[model samples]
Target: MKKLFIMLLTAFVFAVVNPTKSEAKVMYDGAEVVKGQTGKMTFKKDIKVYKKNPNGSFDSLVVKRNNFFKTYDIEKYDGKTFYQMGQYRVQATDLVVFKEVPIEIRSSFYNDPIYININRDNGMGSYGYYFLRYQLTFLDNGYVDHCFSDGDEGTDCDRYLGTDFKITERIEREYGMRYEISKNAEGKGVPLKESKTEKIMEKGSIVFAKGLEINGYLNVGIEGNDQEYFWVPVNLLKPVGDK
Candidate 1:
C-alpha cells in the first residue's frame, strides 16, 4: 500500500507540473493582433517601452527584448515558445485598463525625454512592456496581444471598459509595461501598424497590432519627480488589418 501511495504521489506531481493542460484559462486578449508566422511571435531584437509623466518625463522602465530573435530570421520572439498561427496562439486577458500599480522613476539620459519607472509585472495582462504602472490607470481598455504593437485605448485618457471586457471581476488589476527607452539605441516605440493576414506576411512588412500603445502613439507625460499618471491610448488593430 505504501508503494502504491508513492506512485500516486508521483502522478500528482506530474499532473501539477503540466497545469497548462488542465487550467481552463484563455491565453491572450481577443483584440490583440499578430502577423508573421502567427504562432508565438519572437522578440528577437532588444526592445524598450516606457511610461511618461504628465510633465512629459518618462516614469517607467519595463522590458528588454531578448536578442535571439534579432540575430536570426526567426518568426516569433516573445520570450516563449514560437509556433505558426492558428496553432498555439490563444485569447486570454489581454487589453490593459488604466488602473493603479506601484512605480519608481529615474532621470532620462540624452536630454531627450525626462524620467522612467517600474510599472506592474504579470504573466497574464501584458507581457514584457505590456503593463500599466501606478499613477496612470484612468483610461479604458486597450489591446495587448501584439507585444510589439499598440493597444486599443483611446487618446485623451478617458476611462472605459478594460481590455478584458470579458472579465467580470468587480476590481481587476490589469496594467501596462514597456521596455528599452534609449536614443543611442533602437527604441521600440514606433507606433505599430496592422500587418496580419490569411495571407503570408511580406519579408519587410511592418508587423504589429493597431493598439494605441505602440511606439510614438502611447500618450504619456512627465509629472512630479517620478510621479505616476495614466497614459493615453488610441485604438486597437489586427496585426493584419485595422480590426
Candidate 2:
C-alpha cells in the first residue's frame, strides 16, 4: 500500500436561503442545510441584490445554469431567483453521500476552534491536522471552494490568518461510493462531544480512530510526522461499503 499524506480538506458549505418572503423558521442546525441558508430564508426573488442595485436594494444575483468551474460568479447576485433561504439541516441519518470521502470516526464540532492530539491509537499522527485562515466562498454555479483564490490580487498572496488544532481522532462521511451512510445509529459514527474508547481501526489499516471537535467553520488539513508538507482532503480512501 502506498502511504499518503492525508490533508482532510474542509468541506465548503454554502449558505442556503429560504425563498419565502413571509414568516419562516429553521428546522436544522444549518451546518449541512441545502436549498436554504441558516437562521432565515427568503423566497422573495423580487428583492434586489444587497449592494449591487443602483437603487440600493437587494440586487438579485444572475447565475449561469451551468457547473463550469470557470466563468462562475457568486459574490454578486446577477439574476438567479432563490427557491428557499433558511436552514435545512442534514442529520447523520440524512447522510446520502457515503462514498465521496473517507469515513472519519469523529465529530466536526464546526463553528469554533478546538484542541486535540492527532496521535492515533498506535502512535500514528494521522489525526493531527491544521488550518490557516480558511473561509468559505461560493462560485456562480454553486461550487464552494476554500477561500484564497487561484491567483493573487497583486504582490499580496492574499494570505489570510487562520486557526490550527491537534486532535486524537476524526470521523467523516466515507468517500467513494457516493451512495449511503448507515441509517442505523448504532453503526453510524457518533456526533460531536461524544467520546468512545473502542479501537475503531483494523490491525493493518491506516486509520484515525480518535475524536476531535473544532468549533465553527474550520479549514481542515493534515500534517505528517516528518512535517515535510501537509495535504488537504486526502485524495484516496473513499468509502468502502455502507456507513
Name the candidate that leads on lDDT: 1
Give the local distance difference test score of model 2: 0.23
Provide TM-scores for the models: 0.16, 0.18
Which candidate tops TM-score? 2
**CA lDDT of each candidate?**
0.26, 0.23
Tens-digit lDDT track for model 1 on 1-243?
A: 999999999999988887655423222222222121111222333333344466877643332343111110112223322121232221111221112111111111112221121112223323223333322342323322222213665343322212221111011211222222222211122212211112222232222322233323342222222432222222221123232
lDDT of 2 at 103: 10
lDDT of 2 by residue, 1-243 (tens): 123323222212222343336533312323232221112222212222222345654434432222111110011012221221111221111211111110111113232322332222313222233332234322344222334444656332221111112222223332222211122111112221222322222222222212232321111221122222111122322323333
Stretches of candidate 2 above 4 Å error?
A: 1-37, 42-45, 49-225, 229-231, 235-243
Candidate 2 global TM-score: 0.18
Candidate 1 TM-score, C-alpha based: 0.16
